[model samples]
Target: MKKQQQLYKGSLNTIIMKLLENHGRMYGYEITQKVKEITEGEMNLTEGALYPALHKMESEGFLDVEMERVEGRVRKYYKLTESGVKETNNKLEELESFVRNMQQIMNLKLS
Candidate 1:
């Protein structure tokens, strides 16, 4: 795997939650495309990876799913639940802390 892909694999859930938190709700493909767009195509989320994570989060009560008919097909949308919002904040905090530690260890300039 490329470096970016490898790095992103560890934080897919946080990324998805943050997106939902910002966007309200999104279908799977929309989430994938948004990630691609935001990352300038450096990151591509495959269905194999995305669906399982969504299902797991839904089961864990971090997300809720809605089915909507669009263009003669049913699309499943994912939205963050109340607990999800809290978890997203926690995950973002953890990620930020990790980054700060890494910066200090590497003697990198803080942002």
Candidate 2:
């Protein structure tokens, strides 16, 4: 499970995009909590990693941010932009292909 969790680290961006694609919009902390809940505590996203990824995606034009004032503080929520949706679809297809290839290789009969 630890090894598998490491593999999941590479898919962080894809995971975030997919979640945003489904949920419409989410704040940074909310996204982290959601991942933790879905993974049942196996995967925890640290601030150092998650924030940089979000910032990079935002700069790449894959995400749009909406800032809201809540209790005298501003919260930034992220949602998929048009390009993000397209990128998410492409990434999902690529991930499926990669998984299939891995499965085939693992199933090879070698004496």
Candidate 3:
């Protein structure tokens, strides 16, 4: 059984971008599974959420998709464009700063 994760706001884009950066290219299901596995099943991404984000990123010119036949099915694999690499860097920096500010405001103490 997978543990339910608390809904953390506004980091999915960063997560997806970072995943692409490491993996080079991935299909949608693979991306979702990788995130869930890496988080030890904490984060389960829904197709509803993942597809829309992927489409938005595609529309934004941050991602390029290639279609390939896999097991008699056409799978769309997503890869980062040059702009995507730049965006990923920016998003990561933004997320890091946001987390830092949040820690400060919440007085998060790590032992």
All-Cα superposition RMSD per candidate: 3.1, 1.3, 3.4
How do all the candidates rank in terms of TM-score, highest first? 1, 2, 3
* Model 2 regions more than 4 Å off: none
lDDT of each: 0.95, 0.94, 0.90
lDDT (tens digit, per residue) of candidate 2 on 20-40: 999999999999999999989
Residue-by-residue lDDT tens digits, candidate 3, 1-111:
333343433688888999999999999999999998998877888898899999999999999999999999999999999999999999999988988998898996767
Q: Tell me, by TM-score, which candidate is best.
A: 1
What clash count does candidate 3 reach? Answer: 0
Residue 91 of model 1, lDDT score: 97
- How far residue 89's Cα lies from its native spot in candidate 3, in Å, is 0.4
Candidate 1 positional error at 30, Å: 0.4
Q: Where does model 1 exceed 4 Å of error?
A: 108-111
Error of 2 at 33 (Å): 0.7
Deviation from truth (RMSD, Å), model 2: 1.3
Model 2 backbone overlap count: 0
Report how far residue 9 has shifted in candidate 3, in Å.
4.2
Which scores greater on lDDT, model 1 or model 3? 1
